[model samples]
Target chain A: MSERTAAPAGQADGRTDDQADRRADRRAERRAERQAEEGERRADPRRRNNRAWLLVLPVVVSVAFTAVIPLMTVVNFSVQDIFSPGDRLFVGLEWFRSVSRDPEVRAAFVRTLLFSAQVLLLEIPLGVLLAVSMPRRGVWVSVTLVLVALPLLIPWNVVGTIWQIFARPDIGLGGWAVNNVLGLEFNYTLDATDAWITVLAMDVWHWTPLVALLAYAGLRSIPDPYFQAAQIDGASAWATFRHIQLPRLRGVLTIAILLRFMDSFMIYTEPFVVTGGGPGNATSFLSILLSKIAVGQFDLGPAGAFSLLYFLAVQIVCYVFFTVLTRTGR
Target chain B: MADIRLEGVGHSYDGGRTWALRPMTWTWRDGRAYALLGPSGCGKSTLLNIISGLLSPTVGRIWFGDREVTGVPTAGRDIAQVFQFPVLYEEMSVYDNLAFPLRNRRRPKAEVDRRVREVSRLLGLEEHLRRRSRRLDPGRQQLVSLGRGLVRADVAAVLLDEPLTVVDPAMKWTLRSELKQIHRDTGHTLIYVTHDQTEALTFAEEVVVLNDGAIVQAGEPSELFLSPAHEFVGHFIGSPGMNVLPAELLDGVVRVGDATLGRASVELPSGPVRVGVRPEFVRIGPAGAASGPVARVTGVDRMGAYNLVHAEVNGHPVIARTDAATTFDAGATRVLRFAEGRAFLFRDAVRCGALEPLDGRAGA
Candidate 1:
C-alpha cells in the first residue's frame, strides 16, 4: 500500500497526477503563509522584555556599597581588638566585662538613656499639636514653614558655640537676662543643676524643628475630605486628632522617634562645647565618656570595647523600637 | 433628621475681596438627595467644604436645622464627606479603619465592634476584615473610605465629592446603584457632587448647576433639562451639548442669518442673541414635518447605536441626534426643522428671550 502511494514511476497517468500534486503544494504553501501571519499576530516579542530591573540596579549597588560595607566593618571592629600597627588580639568577653564595670561608663549610659527619653516625651506631641493648629493654604503657611526650618539649617557645632557664649554669666545676653532681669542665681559653669537645664534647653532649641517639620509634612499631606468625614461622623476635636491626624502621622512619627533617639543618645557636641563635660562630670553622656577613654586616657583596648558596647546598646534600643513601630503600624 | 439652610451664603479666599462662590441661598430638606453639579473650578467643592463646616463663609450664614453653624469647626458639625480620592489609614486593618472614629469617641468596645461588623456587612467587607487597607485594590480602598463615612448612622448629612470618579467603568454602575440603595436604606440627608451629568441626574432628586462662581440654575432634574436658566446650563447638561447660533432679535422674532424663527416677542435687551436647541429636538432631511427654520446637512456620523447628523442652517453648524433606523448619506442637502416649543433664545448668554413650544407636544 505504501509503494502504490509513492508510485511516480509510470509515464502518462503519473504526469497528470504530478500536476495535481503541484497544485496541492501551492495550496499547502498558501495555508502556511496564513498560519505564519496568524502566529505573528498572536505573539508579540516587544512587550515581553520590558523588565525595569536595569533601571533599579544602580540604586541597589549604591546602597550596598555605602550602607552595608560600613555596617559590616563596624560589626567586625566590635568583636575584635587592635594593639599597635598590624597586630591584633582577640580576648572574648574580656573588654566587655571591663567596660561594663567602669563607673564612668555606667553613669554615662544612665544619663544618655534618661536624656533621650525626656526629649522624646517633650517634643513629639508638641510638634504634632503645632502642626495641627497651623493654617492651611495661605501666605502665612509659607512664612511659618520658612521660620520653622531656619533653626534646623544652623550647623550642630555652630549651635553649640552660639549657646556657649549666649549662656555666659557676665557678657552673654541669656545669662545676664536670667541672672539680673529674672533675679535667678544661674551659672551653667558653676552649678550642676544649671548645666543640665542649659543642655536640655539647647537640645530642644536645636532639634524641635526637626520633629515639627516631619509632623507638619504629615499633617499637610492629609486631604480636606478626611476632616469632612470626621465632622460628618460627629467626632470631637480630640477624637479627630487621635483617629485621623495621629494615625496618618504614624510613619513620620516613628521616623522622628528613631532619628531623634539615635541622635540624642549620641549627643556630645552641644554639652561638650558648653561645659567641656565640666561641673564635675554632670552632663557626661556615653559619647563624651567614650571620647574621654580613647583620647584623654589613651586606653584603646577598653575604649574600643566601650565604644562597641555603646553601639550595641543604641542598636538594640533602635531595633526594638523599629520592631514595635512596624508591628503596630501594620 | 435635620434640614440644612443656607441664606445668601457666599465665600471668598482673599478676605472676601474676590469671590470663589457667589451668594447661594438654598435649603436641603431632610432625606433628600441633592447634587451640586459643575465643571472644574466652578466652586462646587468650595460650597461642599463650607457646608461641611471645614470652611466658614466670607458672607451670609449657614444653618443646620434652626441653629446657625457658621462659626463651628468641622468636628463640631455632624456631617460626613467622601472625597474624590480615597483617604484612609493605610497601615490599619479594615476593622480598625471603620472602628477608629467610634473608638476615639470613647465608645464602648462592644458597641464599636457591633458597629464595625454591621458596616462591614453593608459594604461587603466582612471577609476582608482582618486585611490591612493598604493592601486592597483602588476600588476596595475607595470602598473602605466610603464605609468609614457611612458607618455611623447618626451623622447629620453625608456629602460625597465625586466619590465614584476613581472607580473603574465596569464597577461604576454597580457602586452608583449601591449608593442609591444605601440612601434608600438609611434616610441620611445626602449631598452629592459630580461633573458627570448622567451620574448627577440618576442619583440626585434636585440638581444645582454652577458656572464660573455662580449658581446658574437649580431645580428638579427634568426641569433643568427642559428649561435651563442660562445658556451655559443649556449647553452643559446635554450630551454633545446644545448648538449655539448667532442670531438677531428683531421685535419678537429670532433671526439666524437669512432665516427667522417665528415666536412671541422676547423682552430682551437689544443685542446679539444665541438660539439654543437640543440635538434630539432638531429634525432634519426634507423637513416639512415640523414648523421651524430650514437647514442643510453638512456631515453624518453613523454611530453603532445612533446617527449623529451635522447640518448648517443660515451658516451656523447644527447637530442632530437621529435614530439608528434613519440613514442619510454624508453631505446630503436636507431640510432641518426645529421641534415646536423646543427652541430657546438667549441674549447676552442669559435666557432673556421666549421659549419654543415643548418637544413632542401636540401641534409642535
Candidate 2:
C-alpha cells in the first residue's frame, strides 16, 4: 500500500508524488468506509430482505405434490404386499430380489439399453447431416424447416400405429415395396429380428428430426464470418463442417443427445403400438414388461420394484451423459 | 506475393437498381500496404470482400498479377482475410487454430507443425499454443486468427476488415505496430479496410478514402494531409477536420462574404465555391485597423495539445487552432487570417487548387 501510495523513489519529484499519495490515501479511506458498511450489513440480519425464500413456495409445493408424493407411494408399494391400502402387509425386499433375478426382466433391461444406444447412434449423425445440408436462407428455409419438422409433429401412438401397418407385407405399400422392389422377405409380426428392427426404425424416424432441428438452430446462431474465414482458409466442405459447424453445434447437440437418451430409454408407446412386445418377446423393453407386470398381471409390488430400478438407471445415465457431454462441449 | 487488380468492378444488391459500389479500376501493387478508409456503408468492406473473393463483383474482372481469378471461389483464391470479429474454432488449441489453413490444404504434419510454430512465434502466441483458442482475450484471439492467415506461406495477400474494432485501446497500439512489423518482415501485400483515419494513416503507405459508396480520394498520408483532392478527404483525414464556408469565385479570386481569401491560377469558375482550411492554419488575431474580415469568438475548446477557437465571420462558422498557451474569450471579436497557401478552394466539393492568400506576406 505504501509502495502504491508513493511513486518509486528517485523516479520523479515528490510534488507529483504528493498528489499520487493523496489520491491513494483517499482510495484507501473509501475502501475502509465500504468495508465498515459491509460489516454492518452482514452483522444486522434484520436490515436485509429475507423474503426471497417465499417466492420458491409454489415450486416446492408443486414438486412435493407431483414428484415426491408419487415417488414415496411407489417406494412404499415396493416393500409391501397390498391387497388394499389398509390391509397391506410388509414383505421387505422380497419383490426386489425376485424381480432383479427374473430372466425376462433382465433381458428387457438389456433390450431397452440396446435400443437407446441404437437410437442415439443412428439419430445423432443422421440429424447432424440433415442439419448441415438444410438451407440457411431464402423461401426454401421455411419449406425445409416445415418438411423436417413434419415427422416430429405426429402423435407418438399414431407414429407407432402408422409404422405397424406400414410394415405389413400384404396391404402396406412400404412393406410391399421392400418385398417386391428389393426381393427381400420381410415380416415384422412373425420374425423377432424384423420386429426389433421395425421398432428401432420407428423410434429413429420419429426422433431424428428433433436432433436435426436443434442442430440447425445451433448452426444458425453462429455468425457468417466464421464460414467466410473458413472458406478463405481453404477448408473443404467436410473440413468446414468438422472445424466450424460441428464445434459450434456442441451446446445444442448436447441437449439433443440428452433428450434423445432419456426419451429413448423411457420409450414405451411407439414400440408398444407397433410391436406389442412382439413375437416371442423380442421387442419387450423394460417399460413394456413393467406395464405388463403391473397392469396385465397385477403384480403391484414387483412393478414398484422395477419402477425404482428404472428410475435409478435413468438417473445414473443422465448424470453421466450430462457430465461427459458438457465437459467435452466445453 | 502478387499485385491485386480490380478492373471495372461494381456491385448492386438488387439487380442493377441501387449500387453498393460503382464500377472502378484499381490496383494494389505487390508487397505494399494500403488502407481503404471510409464511413459506415461506404463500400469499403464490400470492396475488401470483392478483393478477397468472398463476394464476387457483379461486373468486371479481378486479377492476381497475371492470373485472372474473376470466377474463382474464395478457397481457390490465394488470399487470407481477418474479419471484423476474430474467427477461431473454440474447441481447438491455439496450435491447431494456427495450423488450420495448412491442415485444410493437406500440408504434411511436420510442415504444419513448423508453420504453426513459426507463425505463433511471430504473433507472440508461443506460450498459449496449447490452450484452447476461446481461452484467450479478444486481442489475443485476433492475433491467433491473424496467425492462421500468416501460417500459409503461399498466400498471395492478406486482407483485413476493421480488424481492431474489438481490441482494447491499449492493445490497439501494440497490435497496429505488430501488424506493421509483420508486413515489413514478410513483405506480403496487405489491404486494410477501416473507417478510422488514424488507423488507416498509421498502418498503410497509401490510403483510399470513400464517401457514400464512391472513392473520394486516394493518396499518400502527407499528400492527404497537405493537399486533399476532395473536401471530404480534408474533412475525414484530420482531427477536428477542415472548416468549410460558402464562397463565390470571380476569375479565380476566392471571395467569402466581403473578404478576399486568395486566388488560384487555374481556370476560374463563375459559380459558387467553398473555402476550405484546416483549423491549424486558421489564425485568430485582434480586430480593428486591419483590412480583414472580423469574427466574433463563440467558444474555445481546450484540447490537451491545442485550443480550438470557434468563431463566426460574416455569419459563417470558422475555427482556429491555437497552441495550448493561446486562448480566446467568448464574445470577443477578432480578424481571421489564413496561412498562405494552406487554404484551398473547392467547387462542387472537388478541390480546385491551393489558394495564394492576397496578403502581401505571401509574396516574399
Candidate 3:
C-alpha cells in the first residue's frame, strides 16, 4: 500500500524520520512525567496506610483455612493409603497410576469431556441467536428478560427432577410427545442414546439462558453509533451482526465461554439427579464416579487422587483456553 | 458528487410537540465543504442525521441533486459518516476495515482493492493496513473509520461528527489536514458537525451556525466573524467573544446611561441597543484625553501575544485586547475608545450599523 504513495521518495523518507523522532521524544517525555508522578506519590504521607492490609487479613486467613489448607490436605491424602485418620501408609504413585489406568475412570473422563464440548457447541450459538432476537428496549425488554430468565431461576436439582419426570416415556409430557406425537420409541431408561439426548437436552434447557443473558448484556453495552454507521455503509443485517455486533462482543463472550466451560466441565448435579449416572455408564461423569468412590465406597485415598487429577484437568484446560481465546483477537 | 437540498427540514423527538431542529430551507452545493457549527444541543447532529437519512424530519422534503430521497434509508442516500469516537470492526485488519463498506455492497473486487489502497495512501494509513484496527491508537483508528467512508468511489458526501474529539491534540492537526486534503483531492462534498468553532472555521468553506435549534447564521467563516447576523453568532464564533453592552439610543446620541459614548448619523430608530465591539478594536487611553466614556481599569492579563485589559464602563465590564508591552495599574482611570468604523450598534440584538463619527455634531 505504501508503494502506491504519490509523494517523492526523498521527502517521504524525511517525513518518516521526522515523525519517528517526534514519537520517540513524546514517549520519553511521557516516561519522565510518569516517573515524576511516582516520585511524588512515594513522598506523599498517605502512602503509609498500613491499616488497609490489616482490614483484608480476615478474608485472607479464612480463604486459607477453607480452600488452601483443605487442598494441601487432599494432596497429602492422594499419596497415602489411609484406612483411618491415624492408620495410614505412604504409597506414592500407586493410586495415581491405578486411577489413570482404570478403564471406567478413563471412559467417564472421555464422556464428561464430550458432554462439555456438546454443551458449549449447542449453547453458545443458540444463546447468541436468542439474544439477537430479543427486544432491546421499551416494555418488551422487561417482559422478555423475565421470560428468558424463568428457566435459570429453577434450582439445578429441580431442573433434573422436572426433566426426569418430563422425559419418562410412559406418562410425562415430553416423553409422551416423542412417543405418541412424533411416533418414536424413546425410553431414556432403556436406550443409551435416549439417555444421552435427555441429559444433554436437560442441561441445555437449564443453562442456555445463562449464555443468553450474558450475551444480552454484552449486546446492550455497544453504543448506538456503531449500528448507525453500519447502516450508512450499506451493510445488510447479517453483515451488520457479523462485523459490528459480533466483533464488539469479544470481551463478554470470552468471559461467558470461560464461565460456561468451567461450569459444564464440573457439572454433576443435574445429570446425577436425572439419570443417576444412567442405566449403564452412559452419563457417569467423573464427578459422579468419584462420588461413588469417595462417599459410597469410602475410599479416601483413591478419591483424593481422582479429585486432584480432576482439578488439574479443569485448571489446564481453562487456563489454556482463557489465554488463547482472550489473546487470539489481538 | 451530489448537491443536497433540504426544504423545511425539521425534527421532533416527541412527535410534533417540540422540535430538536426547526424547519429551515438550505442547499449544500456539490463538491463544497461545509460545517454545521453550534454549541451542544444546538441540533447540528440532528440536521446532519436528517440529511444523511439516519433520521426522518418531522416536516419537510429533502433532495440529493434531482432525486427526492426524503424516505430513503441512510445507505440508499449514498452518503458516509464518521462518528465522534472511532467505530471499527475490532477483530478485522485495517485493510479489511477499509474494505468493509465496499464488501457489504458487493462491489467488484478490483474496484474495492483500488479504492481501499487509494484511501489508505490518502490517510497515511498504508503501513498500518495489515494491523488489527483495535490495536492502533485512537487517532489512527479514526483514520481507519474515515477510510472506510472514503474507500467507496460512489459516496456522495462525507459527514463528520466531532471526529477530532478523541484524537490527541498533537495528532489533530495532521488528521484535520488529512481530511481537508481528501476533500480537495476527491472533491466529495463534506459536511462536518462540531461544537468547536476552530474546527468549523478552519475546515469549512461555509459554516452554518445554529443556536437553540435555529439557524443563527450560515455564511463564510470571515462573514460569521466580521458580519455575524445574530447576537448569538457573535458571542459563539470568537474566542473571548464579542462584547455586548446595553445602552439607550435617542436623538442620534448613544449613551450607556447618562454618559454619552458616541452618535450614529445613519437612519436608525431610537430605542435600547447593544454596543458590540471586538476586544481587538478597543483602544485604551488616559482619562480626560479620549472623547469616550471613562472606565476604571480592574486588571491586566498578559496573554503572551497580547494583554487583556479588563475594565468597567458605567458599571458594565469590558475586555480590551492591547499590545503585550502595555500595562496598567489596577483601579487606574482610563477612557475606552472604539476604533472608527469597527464598533457596531445592535438594536434588539440585531446589527444596526457601524458606529458613526466621534464628534457630537450630527451629519447632514
Error of 3 at B157 (Å): 1.1
Cα lDDT tens digits for candidate 3, B58-170: 99999998999999999898899999999998888999999999988898999899989999989989999999899999989999998888888888789999989999888
For model 2, the chain A TM-score is: 0.84
- lDDT string for model 2 (B1-364, tens) is 7788889999988898887999989888999999989999989888889988889899989999999999999889989899999999889999988888888889899999998888888989999999999999999999998898888988889999899999999999999999999999988999899999999999999998988778888889888988888999989999889989888888877777776666774777576888898998887767764555678999999988888899998888888899999877899998878887788888789987777755564321
lDDT of 3 by residue, A45-141 (tens): 7976788788899999999999999998888989999998779999997999999999999999999999999999999999999999999898999
Clashes in model 3: which pairs? none
Q: In candidate 3, how many Å is residue B62 off?
A: 1.7
Question: Residue B266 CA error for candidate 1 (Å)?
Answer: 6.0
Backbone collision tally, model 1? 6
**Model 2 TM:** 0.90
Ranking according to lDDT, highest score first: 2, 3, 1
Per-residue error (Å), model 2, residue B201: 1.5
lDDT tens per residue, model 1, A126-188: 777778877777789989888888879998888989999999879989998999999999999
Model 2 chain B: lowest-lDDT 10 consecutive positions: B355-364
**What are the C-alpha RMSDs, in order, of all predicted structures?**
12.5, 7.0, 7.4
DockQ of each: 0.31, 0.64, 0.63
The model with the greatest TM-score is 2
